[model samples]
Target: MTRTPSVSVVFVCHDGAGRILLARRSTRARDEPGTWDCGAGALEFGETFEQAVAREVIEEYGTGPEKIELLGVRNVLRPGSHWVAIVFAVRLDPAEARIGEPHKFDELGWFDPAELPSPAHSQLPETVALFT
Candidate 1:
């Protein structure tokens, strides 16, 4: 059976500066363990994009988004899978953000967009570029 493309909500949680938050996925993560990625998750059946963004951020970061703006959408197709991701620029106090899920993320940090950490998630660069 052919699987339908998944819908995801992505958030670039920024500190109102040029720095964006990235989390290093732990070994328990599905695809890219040890790779840095912005906060994202599959959108639940009844959740709105904004709601998913808020829920995912809080679930992953331990804090809520103070402000969220729709950036754009990305249609991603890999060899055997696809997804449409609705991206958003989320502003939150960097101090308030922490690793809420230790099993999912090993480390989290804020970095300059121009100097992102190594071993980043494959789609992170392009997904981040959509903000500008």
Candidate 2:
């Protein structure tokens, strides 16, 4: 039996200015260890898109979304995983953001769009570019 492509919610957290929050993947991360990436998670079976985005944001950053907008969608594919990502532009208080899941993320920071950190996750640049 073949498996179906899953759904994921990718949120770009901004401070309503120009700084976007990014988290560095820890060595124990599922993929792309030591790479900076936006907050993301699988879309649950019965949850709405906004709900998924909000949950992921809070779970990863210790903050909730103040405002959320549907940016666009991207079809992400790898050797063993395929998913349609629902991209979102979320606004939140940067002061309330932290590494909620330290086991998965090692560092978190707010960066200007033009001065992003090096060695970002393979899909992060494009994902973030969509909202820019």
Candidate 3:
């Protein structure tokens, strides 16, 4: 089997207030089911990071970002996969969020940053730290 690293646009959406949006991974998710996580998607061919973020936000949350800000980048390595994570903090309207991808996410919630849900995604801690 041939393996290659992929690039992902990882984003956490906020309302410009103190609340951040998270999705609960469904059993059908790629990994870490039952865990709470921010949104992410593979970068499409010829697409810029910003373009990927916008597409993913609409796909995952059914909402568009009001503002997108670059956070940082990380080389994410797990047991079977590796990715270059391009992180972003996106501001959006809280009222418009929904579980756009039913197979991947079972729930969507707006949470206070300090009171996040239990059993977070493996990369969540590092990703959340970049929100500021």
Off by over 4 Å in 3: none
Which residue pairs of candidate 1 clash?
none
lDDT of 2 by residue, 1-132 (tens): 888999999998999999999999999999999999998999999999999999999999998999999999999998988999999999999889989999999999899877779889999889989879
Q: How does candidate 2 fare on TM-score?
A: 0.97
Query: Considering every candidate listed, which one attains the maximal TM-score?
Result: 2
What are the per-model C-alpha RMSD values against the true structure? 1.0, 0.7, 1.1
lDDT at position 30, candidate 2: 91
Supply candidate 1's per-residue lDDT for 131. Answer: 66
User: After TM-score superposition, what is the CA distance of residue 91 in candidate 1 from its true location, in Å?
Assistant: 0.4
On residues 10-56, what C-alpha lDDT tens digit does candidate 1 reach at each position?
Answer: 99999998799999999999888999999899999999899999999
Compose the digit string of candidate 3's lDDT tens values, residues 1-132.
Answer: 889999999998999988999999999998899999999999999999999999999999998999999999989999988999999999999989888899999998899877779999999988998885
Per-candidate TM-scores read 0.96, 0.97, 0.95
Model 2 lDDT at residue 44: 96
